[model samples]
Target: MLITKIYKPAEVEKAADELRKGELIAFPTETVYGLGADATNELAVKRVYLAKGRPSDNPLIVTVSSIEMMEKFATDISDDARKLIKHFWPGSLTFVFKIKPGTLSKTVTGGLKTAAFRMPENEVTRKLIELAQVPIVGPSANSSGKPSPTTAAHVYHDLEGRIAGIVDDGPTQVGVESTIIDMSTNKLVILRPGAVTREEIEEVLQKKLDTDHHEVGKDETPKAPGMKYKHYAPDAQVLIVEEGKWEAALNWAKKQPYLVGIMAPGIEEKTLSKNFVFFDLGNNVEQASHNLFAGLRYFDDKKDVKWILAAGFAEQGLGIAYMNRLKKSAGDQFFID
Candidate 1:
């Protein structure tokens, strides 16, 4: 693992000290552990891209301790954007806003005109930002194109020796990334879905939000992270089984003569048959979202697991975010029959 020191929440001041030195520190957020750097420090942000092996064109999300800090780095916040930010700040809602002139490194924005800014509700994250005294652009602690890390251990596994330090505040409360909204548009667009559903935002706004979800290519510039990458996939290939056809899927797997990895809700682990490694994601959509990536990472370590059969979940609430990751990781491989 890459952690030289795993700091506790009480030690955020030390982590912040590292940040001011233009170092990369992995810290816990409400959504996931992020590889954080001083956003305005060009060299520090460059280390983040290098440590994650992230594409230079893929912009990072600048996390703030408060609304006042966000204003220092972002500009041209519309009334609608301000309203949504007032409602969702200190939560898992990220907004794409126009950047202030020379406020952040070009690397942080990928030289784009706009930048993503967020205020995660996790206290540890806020404390770190408060201590650092600058906007911190934090992407998932894992390497580029990997499942976003929800725990510090996952961060260590993917970025060992690459980062300066890690703050182990335990597993994240929201197991997925934040919901990103493109307020740079005339009409707000849902760039990425997460624990905070679109419905929740609409309820606060009393207006419909545009859903903008088309996978982008590596060669193109995506409006936000998770928009155009093969993300959240484990080493084994994963497939989503259509509803009511799970029985057929089980039978098909039984004929393969190879061990199968299954991530499904309502799984009868004690009664399930065959040479299979079963991961119970629970029946509740929120539970599934919480356990989804951890389950995938669990199955990834299984030597006999070659394919993962995941039960389809309704795209409502957290399920929308869960299914989005599932679809990307599954590589469009859905069980039709």
Candidate 2:
């Protein structure tokens, strides 16, 4: 097994050196801890896929510290993309642009003509890229198909001894992935929804954005992560329940002698039976968004939990992102009342 060191904030220079040497480093971002590598270095980029057990076809996001750096890697940035970048970059949004030829690895692009780019505002990661003198493809630092980690410790649990080092800066502010938009063509389409919502982007661009269109064609490769993948799923079978079908589902779950985990918006444990493990995500949708993945992972760790019964949310603001991840993880096990 590989030895992974957890470094404090002051040791970021060392982390940069490790990155420059073409090794993996798990670092925090506004959204989540990202397993980062030199984007231009083809072999180093491959190591990210190797360490995360991510499918080779899922493209990675090349992160930059500045707009100048972003321009170096992507060309023909549209006015709308620029407006979004100006307002949202160095924050939690990613834009898919036509890549500057030969500037990045085919592995980083996943053999696509365009690549997604983000300029994360996280100080440690921004500086890490600056110090390394190369762009870093920052994917969620977790094993593929698992909950996206929101803390440094979660990264360690998933990637310890697999990567080079971890820049331990504590939990991320936004507990989801970056919002992804494909701007390679004039008509932009959202590839993945995340902390950045479509309403927020529309507010800045003064134009309604495409909230759909991630359906993967038979022979077409997905342009971004989460577009054509069943991700963030725990080992337990996740079943999405209709908004008010809790009692019916509970009765069905009780028939089996296994533990049923219930995830809802409020304190549900007080009313739950012994065979049920209750996870109250939070009082509000934002709080629910923050706690969603963590709750999933928590329930999955409970050896008694053989099935997960998750509640669905109305698609609004960040709720859209929360539901996107939830539905993807739930697969076809949706129970519509």
Candidate 3:
């Protein structure tokens, strides 16, 4: 077993050194912790898939510190792509672009002609990338099908022995992944909804985008992560509680044979029975989105938690990103009675 070290914020150089040595290291981003490997190193990239138990065909995002780093592999960048990059690069948006043949290995591109790229807002991560002198193939640093790691500790929990180290930079602010836009073709499509909303992207480009978040067939290669797999699911069964259904959901929870977990906003803890473990989702949709994955992870640690009744929000703005992840976790099941 490898000794997984937690690199302090001041120790990102060491983390970068590990990446240079072709070892897997988890680093913080505005969205979430990313399991990073030298994108140019086929062996390192392949190890990332093995470490996360991720499918080979679900392409990983090549995280760059600069547009030049992305330009090394991605080509045929469109005007709209440049506009979005000018406005949202160094932030929570990833773009898929046609790649120059042989620039990136098939391991990083999933044998596709295109690849996804992002420049994260986190300074330490950018410095690590710059120091390493190569863009890293970054996918959420967790076991496959699990909630994305929002903190360094979460990464350690899921990938301690499997990885080299984690660069600890506290909890992620966006608390979700970046919005992925496919600009490789004429029809601009959103393959994943995230901290960056559809409205924000539309306003930036002055054009609406098609939502192409459908499941990828068994033989197909997904253009982006989260499109071809069951993602963000916890060990406990998650049931989304739609608006105005909290009372019914809680009542239903009280009668369950096993301990039920509650993840909602503004619920008085004292009013709940011992049968339910309450995880407050905070006051508004933003806070709820920020707290969603952490709450799911919390319930998962409690071995008795067999059911999780998580609150749902309106699919608008950031809520769209929030609900997107929640829906996948809950398998689109809402409280019915």
Query: What TM-score quantifies how close candidate 1 is to the native fold?
Result: 0.96
Cα-lDDT of candidate 2: 0.86
Per-residue CA lDDT of candidate 3, range 141-160, in tens? 99999999999889999999
The candidate, 1 or 3, that scores higher on lDDT is 3
Reference-based TM-score of each model:
0.96, 0.96, 0.99
Cα lDDT listed for each candidate: 0.86, 0.86, 0.92
The candidate maximizing TM-score is: 3
Q: What's the distance in Å from true for residue 103, model 2?
A: 0.8
Compose the digit string of candidate 1's lDDT tens values, residues 1-337. Answer: 3446789888989999999998889989878889899998898898888888888888899999999998887888998888888888889999999877877777888778899989989898899999999888889998887778888888888888888899999998778889999988688899999878999999998999978866576588887888866788888889899779899988888777778998888768876667788998888778778888888888877978888899878888888898998888899799766
Give stretches of model 1 more than 4 Å off. Answer: 1-3
Model 1 lDDT on a 0 to 1 scale: 0.86
- Write model 2 residue lDDT over 1-337, tens digit each, in one string: 8799998989999999999999999988988889999888899999899899998888999989889988988999888888888788689999899988888877988899899999887998898889999889999999999999988888888888999899999888878789999899988788789899999988888887886554776566788887877788988889988677877887787777989888877645777777888888777778878888888888868988988988788888998888888887787588643
Arrange candidates by TM-score, descending.
3, 1, 2
Best candidate (score: lDDT): 3
